[model samples]
Structure formats: C-alpha cells, structure tokens
Target: MLVDSHCHLDHLDLSDYQNSLDRLLDTARQRGVTQFLSVGVDLPSSSRLVELAQTRDDMLVSVGVHPLQRESPPLPEVTELLSLGSQPGVVAIGETGLDNYYDKDNAEWQEQSFISHLQAGAQLRKPVIVHTREARAQTMAILRDYASTSSGGVIHCFTENWDMAKAAMDLNFMISFSGIITFRNASALREVVKKVPLENMLVETDAPWLAPVPYRGKQNEPKYVVEVAKAVAEIKGVGWQQVAEVTTANFQRLFLP
Candidate 1:
C-alpha cells in the first residue's frame, strides 16, 4: 500500500525492464509500491501523463512547467494551466516553483509561472505540487500570497530547513522527502525528518534519479521508495510499516481528497 508520491514515470530509463513501462510498474507493485504520482514538468509531459493515468487506477498526475525549464518560452498562464489541469486523473497543479540555484537570472519569469499555477489550483480546487530550491524566501512569500487554503499542496522532494518545512505546513502543504534523505551527507536533512510529523509527511523516489543507499548509483524507480521510507522510519524512530501506512494516508488525503 506504499505510494511513490512523486516520480516521472515517462522519463524513466526502462532498459532493465525490457523497455516496458508495464513491466517496470509490475516490479514496483511486487515491492508493495502500489500507487504512483507521475509528475509533469511541462505541457507535453503533462498531457502524456494524463493519458498514461487514464488506463491505470493506481496512478495520478500533476501538471505544470518546472522553473528550471528556462528554454520553454512564454511562461504558463492561469488559463493555460486551468485548461489542462482540469483533465481527468490530473490531481494537482504543479511541479512548479522557484529554482534560483540553477537559474537566478530568470526569477521574475519563474515567479510569474508559479503564481499562475497557484491561481489555477485555487480556481480548480486542486492541490499544487511545489518544487523549490535555493529560493525559499521568495518561494514561501509567493505561496503565502497566492496559495489558497482550500487548494492545499505538497512541497515535493523537500531539502530545506525546519523553518521552511514548518512554514509550508502552516500553509497547508505536506513536506515530501525523496531518496536524498538517505545520503551520507544528509545528516541535517535527517534532523528535519525527525521533526516533521508523520501526519504532514509523504515519500517519493523522483525516479530515474536520486536513488537511495545501496541503490544510489543505480537507476531509481518507484520500487526504491521503500528505501526512502526506511530512512524516514529510522530517523523518526518508528517502524517502516508505520511510515508506509502514514505516508500513504497523507498522500491520499492531499491528492485524492
């Protein structure tokens, strides 16, 4: 019943699965990872994910452009986001937010896009999936301004401090941890994990990247989310089964509600 709350299924390198997505998902299912949220980084990717989710009851999706996609011109409008975000199986509004670490020069553009997604989420009554890095202040400010309490969301792959985590939770956002939490140098992140309640937490792999320990050098998949859960459990001083149950419940409460 574990869920990979975030991942890019379409971007996975399926060579080890006989180049078959179904085979890859079956392997994940066999590992107890029965549900997935295949996040979209752009309109084309979003459309493909919606199509992919239509055939599988266990799959859901989020639609929006990534802030690091500086090459994708024109930025997204609220109308554009609403049009696509309203589609079936699209449970959330973004993988969107500020990413000043990679492209600080385009802060204005990213902020505009982020706000549009937030607006769309509010209007559609769907949650937003936020991706934030090195722009915590601006990210939290924009979220505080534009995010509606009724359209609560999750901060996917969170690597920020306890302050930001608490801030996001105060804004009705769950803090999702990825495989990065298992890294040897993530001791600080582990401390953050200890403080975040299981009620406000979710787990993910962000697969095709950031695989957990023992699988760190290998291509990541939804199946490896178990390792992320194991890390959270150890940090929280709880059982992995408890982590799985609580995170799955949190995921359903946020995305499927």
Candidate 2:
C-alpha cells in the first residue's frame, strides 16, 4: 500500500472534506493508497489534526506554525511541541521551514519559527514535516545548523533542484513530491524526482492544492497521491508498484522511527 506522507485533510472545507474523505479513501485503496499523513499548518488546526488521529489509526499528524500565518505564536516553550510529538498518532513537527514565495519580508520570523520546530523535533526524536519555497539557501543552512538533532525530516512539496534535494538528503531529509510533480509543466521537478533515490523519497498530495495532471484545476486530496507515485515511477523508469512499496516503507521508517 502507498502512504501519502503529507496532506491537509483539515484545511478543506468541512462539508467538502466530509463528503469526499470516505470516497477518497476508497479510491485510494483501490488505487493502492492505503495510509496517509494529515498535516497541520498551524496550532489550532494542529490540535484538530491530533484529535482526528485519536479516532483514525490510519491518519497521523504534524504540528507547527505555517510560514504564511502572521499571528504571533504562543509557546509554553518548545517543550509544548515535544509534548505534542509524544502523543499517539502525531508523527512530526512541521509544515514549518520557510516560504519566501508568499512573503519575502517575513523571512526572519519564518527562520526563527523553523528552528524552534527543528529543535523540538530533536527533543522528541520525531522526524519533521518541512516546507521550503524560494528560500532554499536559508532552509538548507538552518537545517545544517540543526543537523545534529533528530533523525531528519522530509522536504514536503519539494519543488527545488537536484542540488537542493541532494543537500537535504545529505542532512538525512527525505524529498517528498506532491501532485505538482504530475503537472506537464513541472519538467524540472520531475527531473529532480528522477535523480532522487527511492530509499530517500516520499510522496504526498498536499490536498486542497496542486491537483495532479488529469485532476488539475480541481481541489486535491489524499487519493491523488497515486498520481504522484505514477509520475515518479514514470520519471524514474521504474515500475509503479516499486515506487509505492519503497516510499511507503520510507514513510514508516521516518515517522514510525
């Protein structure tokens, strides 16, 4: 079975998510996508994600502040994050990292928040759920700064180059491709996917955004992760089943590590 290593199951409109979740799972199951990780973008939603995990064994969660949110975060300290990480069904500590694509001016804050998250993941010995966009230099540097920490994490929604992917992997990070990789226009990303080794790779949907090729222009969901796996398999000239098994195993190793 395949595992969608990253997705925003809570961000989609409640009714829409509710309407489609079951069918989405059914479709994914038929398509060989058996498990998924529901990512969290901020504190409140992170809490909600944890709640969902309590009821759904197949679902897991990550907690952190999304780079896009301007609200000053509350911290009882980084221990709060470690405490959350210790909870059952909660596997990682991000959607953290940086995103200069949205607001370049917020770079400083994003870096600070991202570091706290890394340190927290270190403390908990949990892998991280990282997000980096247009800030590859800073992201890699920060990751290096904290390299001595926990095992490592995945660069979720990876859209960067081979060099960047190599750097992250050197630091022990996994490169996760989302639906964007399936787009006809994302040749560069597909090229990177081709070069990345399957043992250090993962697949995600990043739902509610970047639906795959045939499903482009519509909302994304976990079920579409199969499209990502298919695209990766095609790019790497490997069988689709091979990509599924390796990435799913990588997911379990990272989060369940």
Candidate 3:
C-alpha cells in the first residue's frame, strides 16, 4: 500500500467529495493509498489536525508552523511546540523550514522558528517534515546543527538539485517528491530522483496543490500520490510496485514509532 507521506487534509477543498473528508479518503483507499500524514501549518491548525487524526485510524499528524506565515504571529516558544507535538497521533514536527522564495523579507524570523522546530523534534524524538524552497544552504546548515539520526526527518516536496539532495541524505533525511515532479518541465528534478536511492526517497501529493500530470490544474487528493510514485518509478527505471512498497516503508520508518 502507498502512504501519502505529506498532505494537508484540513486544507483540502472537499466540495467535490460531497464535503466529506471520509468520502475523499475512501476514494484514496480504493486507489491503494492506505495511510496519510495530515500536516499542520501553525498552532491552531496543529490542534485541529490532531483532532482530525484521532477520528481516523489511518491518519497521523505533524505539528509546527509553515515558513511562509508572514502575516501570522511569531512562532510559539519551543516548549509550546513540544507540548503540542507530544500529543497523541502527532507523529512529526513541522511543515517547517526556511522558504526564501516567498517570504525572504522575514528570513530571520523563519530561521528562528525553524531552529525551535528542529529542537522540538530532537526533544520529542520524532521526525520532522521540512519545507525548504529558495533557502537550501541555510536550511541544511540549521538541520545539520540540530537534526541527527535520532531526530531525523524528510525534506518534503523536494525540488532542489542533486547536491542538496546528497547533503540532506548525509544528514539522515529522506527526500520526498510531490506531484510537482510529474510536471513536464521537472526533468531536472527527475534527474535528482534517479541519483537518489529509492530507500531514501518518498512520495507525496501536497494536496489541494501540485496535482500530478493528467490531474494538474485540479484539486489534489491522496489518491494522486500514486501518480507521483509512478513518476518516481519511471524516473528511477523501476516498476511502480517497487516505488509503492519502498516509499511506504520509508514513510513508516520516518514517522512511525
């Protein structure tokens, strides 16, 4: 079975599913998507995600603020994040890291928030779900400083070059590709996928966004993660079964205790 290693279930546009999250998830299960990590973008969203996970056996959660919340309040203290992350069904810390691509003006605040999240993951002994955009170097540096095998994580929705992928792998972090890699212009990212070992790679939909080809320009769901996995297998010159089996295992290894 395949796991959607990262997604925002709380944020998905469920109008098409009769406004039913269960109907949406059931559709994904029919497509072989067995588990989901419904990511949180802030303290309030984290609380809501934890509640959502508790209602479904197949769902888990990650707590922490996203890097591009410029209009949002400053991140809570590390203690507060730890308190939230340690809650039941909360398996990871973050959808957090530096995103210079859009929020460059608040880079310092983002870095501070990222460090606190890294520390929280270490303290909780849970993996993190990082989101790095145009700030790869700084992101990696902070990760190297705070994260280790015991508190390792995955770089979700990875769109960087092989050098960055290699660097993140060296730090015991897995590289996860979203539906973006299925785009026609993502040949460079596909090349990165070829160079990275399948054992250290994962797949996500980043849903309600970045839907894979054939489904691009539409609302994404966990079922679409299969498309991302198919793309990865194609890039790595392997079968879809191998991508499904390995990436599912990779998700379990990182977020399942």
Most lDDT-accurate candidate: 1
Predict model 1's lDDT versus the native: 0.93
| Alpha-carbon lDDT of model 2 | 0.84
Runs of candidate 2 with Cα error greater than 4 angstroms are 14-20, 72-76, 148-150
Candidate 1, 67-145: lDDT as tens digits: 9887787889888899989999999999999998889999999999999999999999999999999999999999999
Q: State the lDDT of candidate 2 residue by residue for 108-201, as single tens digits.
A: 7788888888898888778888888899899889999984344799899999999999999988899999888877788888889879999999
- Comparing 2 and 3 on TM-score, the stronger one: 3
- Provide the clashing-pair count of each candidate structure: 0, 0, 0
Count backbone overlaps in model 2: 0
Predictions in order: lDDT: 0.93, 0.84, 0.90
Residue 91 of candidate 1: its Cα lDDT? 92
**Model 2 alpha-carbon miss at residue 59, Å:** 0.6
Where is model 3 poorest over a 10-residue stretch in terms of lDDT?
Answer: 68-77
TM-score of 3: 0.98
> Candidate 3, 62: how far from true, in Å?
0.2
Instruction: List clashing residue pairs in candidate 3.
Output: none
Q: For each candidate, C-alpha RMSD in Å?
A: 0.8, 1.8, 0.9
Which segments of model 1 are wrong by more than 4 Å? Answer: none
Superposed model 3: Cα runs more than 4 Å off: none
Candidates sorted by lDDT, descending order?
Answer: 1, 3, 2
Candidate 1 C-alpha RMSD relative to the actual structure: 0.8
Which order, best to worst by TM-score?
1, 3, 2
